[model samples]
Each structure stands twice: as structure tokens, then as C-alpha cells.
Target: MNLLFVADPLSSFSVKKDSTLAMMLEAQAKGYAIWHCHIEDIKSVAGAIYAKSQKIKIDMAGSPWYVSTQTKEMKVAAFDAVIMRKDPPFDMSYVTATWFLSQAKLEGAKIFNDPVALRNHSEKLSLLEFLQYAPPTLISYDLKDIQDFHREHQDIIIKPLDGMGGMGIFRVKSDALNLASIVETLGDSGKRALMAQKFLPEISEGDKRVLVIGGKAVPHGLARIPQGGEVRGNLAAGGKGVACPISEKEAKVAEHIGPLLASRGLHLIGLDFIGGYLTEINVTSPTCFVEITQQTGYDVAKQWLTSLEQYLK
Candidate 1:
């Protein structure tokens, strides 16, 4: 099988923890041909999607992770599967890339996480669909509305619509002197919209990442604990990763959401939780494959590939 990965440049990948790299290595070990392409590499030629793609060889144990063997402009249907592993800020370019991939999807190439679903699902606002499982949340551009939420909740977390890795996330307390400033900055003086959630003190315990693959929950979830004075438990924000057995509640949540999401073309998803409340639904580039595997002895990437093989069959 020939598998194409539409993602960032190979040189930019962090081999130690990148889930896409892990999946690629697993596919290589299984003797599949590996192809690489950047989002910009994709183009529409006479209304058909084509990519300036490269056939690549990888050495995970080596200093340089990948070496391109050859490059060519190929139709998207040339590959058996296309893994859309592009990381997110969910900007205009990302949306345009998805539109390109959607053309490939229509032309009979399998695309992971379904380009159509990715466009429909906003990682932050997607939680609204399951509001019963989430904390009190508000998406607004008005500073007055946000301030009212903060006053009602006493503590809240505010973030921009497209932020990831905890960037642009702020925790505001009722007594915080800069609460109004935070709202202004995140809301961009009422021009840019932001999401605000009632702060769950359970965040102090940990922010759990529950990975669901092929409509089933992985038995273990990675609990990222905030470090020092940081309020964000994102690994990029200096949080410590600890593998925790999935709680019954979390497992139920994953089981309920996983298949539904998979049916929409999101076979792999990362559901974030603080306490028992669902925080965010990450469909674009959900991570923590290595961290959980190292701690819990579960080869998540291998399992994912095994499932993918079954899915393809």
C-alpha cells in the first residue's frame, strides 16, 4: 500500500513525541510505501487535485529522520491512503488545504479524519454539541457578555477560537485585576470572538487526554499536570505527562462520542477532560501516542495501524 502524509515539512517534526511520525514509522515497518507532501504542495489542476509529492525513506534511529528518494507531481488517487496530519491553528490556509483534500476524497482516495468533518468541527466550539458533559461555556465577542460570565462563574478560562497548545488561553478569577484586559485582548476589542468556560478546579489535578481510535477508547489516558504557576495543562505549556488508567466516566464519554465522530470520518480523536467535564474535542492532529505508550506499555501507534488495516480491508 502506498500511504501519503499531507503535513508540515519532515525537518520540523519532533521524532520523540510526534504522533504522525510514529504512524509513519509503523506503516514503514509494515512494508508500505511512504509519501510526503506539504499543504502547499497540493494544487488543483483542471479541477482535479494533484500534489508535488515525494517518496521518502525514514530512519527513526538516525539524526535526520527522513530522506526523500524521489519527487514527482502525482494525482491524489495514486496513493491508497492519505493521512491529513497537519497541525492546527485552523486558519484560512488549513481550511483551503482541507478543501483540496476533499477533492481527493471525492476521487476515491481514503483521507484520515475526513476533510469534510475537519472543516465542520471547530475544536473549541465542537464541545457545545455535548454541552451536558461540559462546563458552563460561552462563545462571544462582547466584553460585557464575557465579563458577565466571569462575574457569574467567579473563575473562568478564556481562549481564542483557533488557539492550540495553550496559546492565548488565560485563567481569570473574580478578583483578578486584569480580567477585563484579558477579555479585551482575547476578544480583540469585540472584533475577534473567544470562548469562555467556568473554571473547573479539577484542572489543578490534571488535564486528561483520552485518545479514541476506530470508535473505541484506548484503555489509558495521559494526564498532563500543570507546572509551577501555569494554569494550562498542555504539554507545550510545561505540563508533566503521566499515564492514567481511563476512568469509567471518561471511558463512557469516549465510547459515546468515538463511533459518532468516526462515522463522520474522524476515526482518530483526542478528547480533553478536566475532572469529568469534557473540555475540548481535538480532531486535527491529536497527540500523546508515545507518552501514553511509554508509560502504559500500550503500543498505541501499532494498534492504530492494525485498526487502519482492518478498516481498509
Candidate 2:
């Protein structure tokens, strides 16, 4: 099978922990052709989508990690599968990328976490779909509303709707010295919207990332434990990743949400849970494959590829 990965520049990937690289390695091991392209490399020609891409070989022992063997322009639909592996702050450009990928989808390319679903699913707000499993949350651009939420929750987390790797996340207490300032900053004087969720002290334990592949939950979770008094448990924010078996509650959350999303074309996703409450549904480039596999010996990348095989059959 020929797989096209629409992702960031390959130069930016760290093979040690990059999940996309892990997937590429697995696919390569299976003798599948691997092609790489950035979102900007995508184009639409006379209603057909194409990408200026490279045929690449991944060498783990090398310094740069991947070596490009050849370069060419190919119709996106020519590939058997198009993996949308772009990391997100889901900006307008990302939205545009999905639109182009949607064109490829219409032209017979199997796009994982379907382009339409990616556009429709907001990482933070999608949790509202299963609010019964989430903490008390409020999304607003109004300072008064945000202040009201903070006051009601006593301890709350305020974050931008379009952030990943724990960027732009703030934890504020009802009596915090900068609560109002933070609201003003995140909301940008009522011009920008932000999410506020009642703080789950269980964060001290870890922020569990439960991966849902092919409508089923992976048996283990990557518990990213925050370090040095940090409120963010993202590995990018210096949190430590500890692989642990999924809890019954975490499994329940993924079980309830996974198939629903899968039916909508999201074949792979990472559901973030804090204190067993669904915090986010990461459809765009959900990670932790390498971390989970290395720490627990559960090859999530292999499971994902196997799921994709089943999906294709």
C-alpha cells in the first residue's frame, strides 16, 4: 500500500517520540511505500487535489532521522491512504488544509480522522458532546461570564480553544491574584473565546491519554505527570510520561465516545482524561504511540496499522 502523510516538515520530527515517525516505521516494515508532504505542499488543480511530496526512508540510527530518496508531485488520491498527521493549534490555515484533504477524500483517498470530522471536531469543545463525563466547563469570551465560572468553580483552568501540548493553558483559583488579568488576556477583552473547566486536583496523579484506535480503546494509558508545580501535564511542557493500564472509568469514557467518532471517519484519536473526566478529544495528530510502546511494550502503532487494515477490508 502507498501511504501519504500530510504533516509538518519531516525535519521537525524527533524519532524518539514522534508518533507519525513510529507509524511510518511500522508501515515501512510492512513493505508499504511511504510519502511525506507538508500541508503547504498540497494543491488543487482543476478540482483535483495534489501534493509536492517526497518518497522517504526512515533511518532511526541517523542524526536527522529520515532521508528523502526522491521528490515528485503526485495526486493525493493516488495514494491508498492519506494520514492527516499535522499537529494542531487548528488555525485557519489548518482548516484550509483539511478542505484540500477533503478534496482528496472525495477523489478516493482514505483519509484517517476524516478531513470533515477534523474540521467539525474542536479538540477542547468536542468534549461537550459527552459532557456527562466531563468536569464543569464554560466556553466564553465575556469577562463577566469567565469570572462567574471561576467564582463558581473556586479553582479553574482557562485555556484557548485551539491549543495543544498544553500551550496557552492557565490555572486560576477564585482568589488568585491574576484571575481577572488572565481572563482579560485569554479572552482578549471579549474578542477571543476561551474554555474554563473546574480544576480537577487529580491532575496531581497524572493526565491520562487514552488512545482510541478503530473505535476501540487501547488497553493502556500514558499518564503524563506534571513536573515542578506545573499545572500542565503535556510532555512538551516537561511532564513525565508513565505508561499505565487504562482505568475502568477511562475505558468507559473512550468506549462511549470512540465508536461514535469512528462512525464519523475518525479512526484514530487520543482522549485526554483528568480525574476520569473527559477533557479533550484529540483527533488531529493524537500522539504518545512511541512513549506508550517503549514504556509498556504495547505496540500502539502496530495496533493502529492493524486497525487501518481492518478498516480497509
Candidate 3:
């Protein structure tokens, strides 16, 4: 099988933790051809989508880790599968890339986490669709409205709508120190929107990342526990990741939501849960494959590829 990964530059990959790299390694082990490209390399010409991509070999022990055997322009449909593994700031550029990928789908390209689904689901805000399992949340650009939410909740977490890896997340306590400042910074003086959720003290335990693959939740989840004085439990924010069995509640929620998202073409999803409440629906580039596998002895990447194979069949 031929697989094309539309991702960031290969130079940026961390071999130790990058889930895309893990997938590539697994695909290579399975004797599948692998190609790589950045979103910018995708283009539309004469109503057909093409990518200026490189057929690459991954060598874990090598200094550079990858060798580009061939670089050529190929129709998006030529590949058996196209994996959208780009990380997000989810700006206009990302949106435009998805538009092209969506067009590619029409041209017979099979893309995972379908381009249209990527465009439709906001990682932080999509949780509103399943609010029965979510905390009290508010998404707004108005500082007053956010402040009112803070006042009502007494403790809250505010973050940018497009932030990832826990960037731009702030925890405001009941005292509300720096509340206005945080509101202005995140909201950009009402020029940009932000999300505010009633703080879940269970964060002190950990922020559990429940991976839903092939319409089922992985039995074990990686709990990213905050270190020191950190309020964010994201691994990028200096947290420790510990893999553990998912709770019954988590399994139930995953069983319910996983198939729905899979039916929408999101073959893989990362559902963030804090204090047993659904927090975010991470559709774009959901990770933790390496950590979960290394810690729990569960091959998440293998499971993902198995699911992909079944999906294609």
C-alpha cells in the first residue's frame, strides 16, 4: 500500500515521541511505501489535486533518521491513503490546506480524519456537542462575559481557541488575581474569542488523554500529570505521562462518541478528560502513540494501521 503523510517538515519530528513518526515506522515494518510532504506542497492545478512529495525511507539509528529516495509530483489519488498529520495553530493556512485536501477527496484521494471533518470540528469548542459529559464552559470574545463566567465559577481555566499542547492556558483562582489581564490577553481585547471552563480540581490527579481509534477507545490512557507548580497537564507543559487503564465512565463515553466520529472520517481521535468530564475533542493530529505503547506495551500505532487497513478494505 502507498501512504502519503501530509505533515510538517520532517526535520521537526521528535523520534522519541512523534506519533506520525511512529505510524511511519509501523507502516515501513508492514512493507508499505511511505511518502512525505508539507501542507504547502499540496496544490490544485486544472481542477486536480497534486502534492510535491518525497518517497522516503525511515532509519531510526541514522543521524538524520530519514532518506528521500525520490521527489516527484503525484496526484493525490495515486496514493492508497493520505494521512493528515499536521499539528495545529489552525489558522487560515491550515483551513486552506484542508480545503485542498477536501477537493482531493473528490478526486479519489482517501484522507483520514476527513478534510471536511477537520474543518468542521474545533478541538476546544466541539465538546459543546456532548455537553452532558462536559464541564460548564463559555466561549466568548467579550471580556465582560468571560469575567462574569469567572465570577460565577469562582475558579476557571481560560485559553485561546486555537492553542495546542497547553499553550496559552491560564488558571484563575477564586481570588481572581490577574483575571482582567488574562481575559484581555486571551480575548485580545474582545477582538478574538477564547474558552473559559469551570476549573476541574481533578487536574491535580492528571489530564487523561483517551485515544479513540477505529471507533473504539484504547483500553489504556496516558495521564499527563502536571509537575511542580504547573496547572497544565500537557506533556509539552512539563508534565509526566503515566499510562493507566481507562475508567468505566471513560470507556462508556468513548464507546458512544468514538463510532460517531469514525463515521465522520476521523479514524483517530484524542479525547481529553479532566475530572471525568469531557474537555476537548482533538481531531487534528491526535498523538501519544509512543508514550502509550512504551508505557503500557500496547501498540497504538499498530492498532491505528490495522484500523486503517480494515477501513480501506
Candidate 4:
């Protein structure tokens, strides 16, 4: 099988924890041809989509990790599967790339986490669809509305709508110190929108990343625990990751949302939870494969590839 991975520059991959790299290594072990490309390498010409991609080999024991064997510009449909694994700020450029990918999909290219779904689902705001499992949340650009929410909740977490890895998150207590400034900065003085949720004190336990693949929950979740005075439990925010069995609450929510999301073409998803409340729906590049596998002895990459094979079949 031929697989094309549309992702960031290979130089930027941290093989130790990169989920895409893990997928590539697994695909290689299975004797499948693998190609790599940046989203910028994609182009539309004469109504056909093509990517200037490189056929590469992943060397797990090597320092460089990957070696490019050949470069070719191939039609998007030529590959058996096109995996969109680009990390994001989800800006206009990313949106435009999805549009191009969507065009490719229309032309018979099989893309995971459907381009249209990725474009439509806001990682932070998509939680509204399943609010029964989420905390009281508010998404608004008006400082007054946000302030009202803060006042009502007493303790809240406010953040920009497009932030990732726990960036631009502020925890405001009842004292409301610098609340106005935080709202102004995150909301761009009412021009941009922000998301505010009633703070879940369960964050002191950890923020769990529950991965669902092929409409089923992976039995274990990697809990990213905040370290020393940190409010964010994201690994990028210097938190520690510990893998543990998913609680019954986490399991129930995953079972309910998994197939629903997979039917929409999001075959892989990372559902974030703080105390039993669903916090975020990570569709665009859901990770933690390496951490989960290393700690739990569960081969996440293998499971992912198995799901992909079944999907392709």
C-alpha cells in the first residue's frame, strides 16, 4: 500500500514523541511505501490536486531517523491513503490547505479526519456539541459577557479560541485580579473571540488525553499532570505524563462520542478531560502514541495502522 503523509517539515519532528513518526515507522515495518510532504507542497493545477512529496525510509536506530529516497510530484489520488497530520495554529493558511485537501477528496483521494470535518470542528468550541459531558462554558468576544461568566462561576479558565498545547490560558479566581486585561488581550478588545469555562479543580489530579481509534476507546489514557505551580497540564507546558487505565466516566463518554466522530471521518481522536468534564476534542493531529505505548506496553501505532488497514479494506 502507498501512504502519503501531509505534515510538517521532517526536520521539526521529535522522533521520541512524534505520533506521525510513530505511524511512519509502523507503516514501514508493515512493508508499505510511505511518502512525506509539507502542506505547502500541495498545489492545484488544471483542477487536479498534486503534492511534491518525498518517498522516505524511517530508521528507528539512527540519529537522523528518516532518509529521503526519492522526490516526486504525485496526484493526490495516486496514493492509497493520504493522512493529514499537520500540526496547527489553525490560521487562514491551514484553512486554505484544508480547502485544497477537500478538493482532493472530492476527486477521489481518501483523506483521514475528513478535510471538511477538520475545517468545521473547532478544537475548543466543538465541545458545545456534547455539553452534557462538559463543564459550563462560554465562548464570546464581548468582555462584558465574559466578565459576567467569570462573576457567575467565581473561578474560570479563559483562553484564546485557537490556542494549542495550553498556550494563552489564564485561570481567574474569584478575586478577578487582572480579569479585564486578560479578557481584553484574549478577546482582542472584543474583536476576537475567547472561550471561558468554569474551572474544574480536578485539574490538580491531571488532564487526561483519552484516545479513541476506529470507534473504540483505547483502554488507557495518558494523564498529563501539572508540575509545580502550573495550572496547565499539557506536556508542552512542562507537565509530566503518566499512563493509566481510563476511569468508567472516561470510558462511557468515549464510547458515546467515538463512533459518532469516526462516522464523520475522524478515525482518530484525542478527547481531553478534566475531572469527568470533556474539555477539548482534538481532531487535527491527536498525539500521545509514543507515550501511551512506552508506558502501557500497548502498541498505539500498531493499533492505529491496524485500524487504517481495516479502513482501507
Better of 1 and 4 by TM-score: 4
Q: lDDT of all the models against the reference?
A: 0.91, 0.90, 0.93, 0.93
lDDT of 1 by residue, 1-313 (tens): 9999998889888788988988998899999999999999999999889999999999866668788899999988778888889998788899999999898888987888799999999998899899989999999988889888888999899999999999999988779669789888777788898999999988888999999999889999999999998899999999999998999999889989999999999989999999989999999999999999989999999988987887788
TM per prediction: 0.98, 0.98, 0.98, 0.99
lDDT by residue (tens digit), candidate 4, 60-84: 7877887889999999988999999
| Per-residue lDDT of 249 in model 3 | 94
Q: What is the C-alpha lDDT profile of model 3 across 80-139, one tens digit per residue?
A: 999999999898889999999999999889999899999999998888899999999999
As for lDDT, the candidate ahead, 2 or 4, is 4
How far out, in Å, is residue 191 in model 4?
0.9
Lowest-scoring 10 consecutive residues by lDDT in candidate 1? 59-68
**Which stretches of candidate 2 lie above 4 Å from their native place?**
none
- Worst 10-residue lDDT window, candidate 3: 183-192
Evaluate candidate 1 by giving its C-alpha RMSD to the native, one decimal. 1.0
What would the per-residue lDDT of candidate 2 be over residues 1-313, giving only the tens digit for each residue? Answer: 9899989888888767999999999999999999999989999988899999999988888867778898999999898898999987688889999999998888988899799999998888888788999999999888888888877888999998877899989998768669878878777777888999999999988999999998999999999999999999999999999999999988887888899999999999999988888899899999999999998999999999999988877
Stretches of model 1 off by over 4 angstroms after superposition: none
Question: Who is ahead in lDDT, 2 or 3?
Answer: 3
